[model samples]
Each structure stands twice: as C-alpha cells, then as structure tokens.
Target: MPKAYFEPEYLNALVEVFHEAKRILERRGITHPVAVDAVARRILSLAQEGVPPWQILGEVLPPMTPEAAGLPEVASTNDIVVSGPAPDTER
Candidate 1:
C-alpha cells in the first residue's frame, strides 16, 4: 500500500476532531482510556477521508435516545441493570 499523505489543514482538522471526540466521550462518562482512544482514532481516520468532524464523531458514539445527550438515565419503576453480558466483559 502506498503511504497516505495528509495536508496541513486536514492534519489540523484531525487534531481538533480527536480532542473534541475525546472530550465528548469523557463528558458522557466514558472513562475507559482504550475506548476513548479507539473512538478518537476512528474519528481521525474518518476526517482524513473528507468526512466532517460531526459525522465522524457520530459514527462512533451512540445517538441520544430522545431523552437528551449525555444525561444520566433516570431509573423508573422498570429499570434493569445487567452485570455482565458476556465472558469477556472487560473493555
């Protein structure tokens, strides 16, 4: 594969996208460092391919389920919490 070259503007845009994405994940209580890094890297790659920053971030993060973005879930009468869904529960 040939080496990919990113222009200065794209590089700057990528940096901004990475920082913003990381901040968004942090604000949403995504404390896993690896998860945040993975999303940031995905956003960077998407930005390099000419995808807008907002779209790139959206691809990795789940959309707000009409309740409001990043808001804590209000436990109602039927709230269920799962301990671990699979064998490899660590992320």
Candidate 2:
C-alpha cells in the first residue's frame, strides 16, 4: 500500500497536536500507553482532514468520567451485597 506523505509544516502540526493531546490526557491521569496511542491515531486522522490543532484537541478529549479516565470504579453501598453464612444443608 502506498504510504501517505505529509508536508513538513503539516507533519509538524500533527506532531505538536499529538503531543499536546497526550499532555492533556496525562494531566487527567490518563497515562496508559494504549490511551495515548489511540489519541495519537485520532489526531492523525483529523490532521489529515485539515482539522486545526485546537479542534483536534477538542474532539479527541471529551469530558470523561472516572471510569472513562481509567480509574477504578468505587462501589457504592447500594452496589455492595452482604451475605450471611450459608446454613447447614444436612441439618
């Protein structure tokens, strides 16, 4: 398959946007490699379509909840079930 080549200025813009997006994610405690790579791919896709860096950032980083930010879910009291010991079945 033919590789897509970008002009130097466009390539620089893409790189800048990618790094900026990554920094934003990291600030939000999203340092996972997979998440970073996914953001990079998204930035590239948008950049190829002539999207501005600010727009790319806006589109890529939506307001995410703790779950979406890769943080562990905290179980609420309603979500927790307390079970008593099982009664002897042979009694």
Candidate 3:
C-alpha cells in the first residue's frame, strides 16, 4: 500500500531540472537566475521529505490563502477551527 499522499514522478523530473540548473549556475559563476530553479528545488526537497504533494504545491504556487488549509473562517465549521496545530490525538 502507498502512503495517503504520493509525490509523482514528474515532480522528481522537475527536481532534476533544478539540479542541472544549479550546475549551470556554478559553471557560469552566475546565480542571478538561480532563484526560480532554487525555489523549485526547495519544493521538491520538501515533497521528498514526506510532505503531501498538495502541501508542497500550496507552498510553491500562489493564491494560497490560509483558507485552503481548512481554516475555520473558510471551512464554515464553527465547532473547531482548522488553523493552528493539528489536534492532539493522544487522548
């Protein structure tokens, strides 16, 4: 069985592109254009770190508001706010 969230192969390919981009930067000794590729690499790294792809996407792409995380103000759920930490499940 797979984890509830799985990072796709295309995402891995993007990471590779970033890697290649970095080499180019180092070769040319110019990192001015590195920011975009660097950000891509960071998102890919986060995805590899076991974060859900959706979460990674949210961090990378824009128009992402606190609402998307199911925060109370957006979710219309008064019983519990979806913001803050994930609820403790110990009890």
lDDT of 3: 0.56
Q: Give the worst 10-residue stretch by lDDT in candidate 3.
A: 1-10
Predictions in order: lDDT: 0.67, 0.74, 0.56
Ten-residue segment with the worst summed lDDT in candidate 1? 1-10
Q: Write the per-residue lDDT of candidate 3 for residues 1-91, one digit (tens) a residue.
A: 3343234655665555456545644544556656756666666666566666545544554343456545566445558547788888998
lDDT of 2: 0.74
* Candidate order by decreasing TM-score: 2, 1, 3
The CA lDDT at 28 in model 1 is 78
Per-residue lDDT, model 1, residue 6, is 59
Model 1 residue 58 lDDT score: 71
RMSD of each: 15.9, 12.0, 15.7
Q: Please write out the lDDT profile of model 2 over residues 1-91, one tens digit for every residue.
A: 3234256756776677778787788888889999888888887777667676556777888767888678998767566556999778995
Candidate ordering by lDDT (highest first):
2, 1, 3
lDDT of 2 at 2: 29
**Residue 69 lDDT (model 1):** 70
What TM-score fits each model?
A: 0.54, 0.54, 0.33
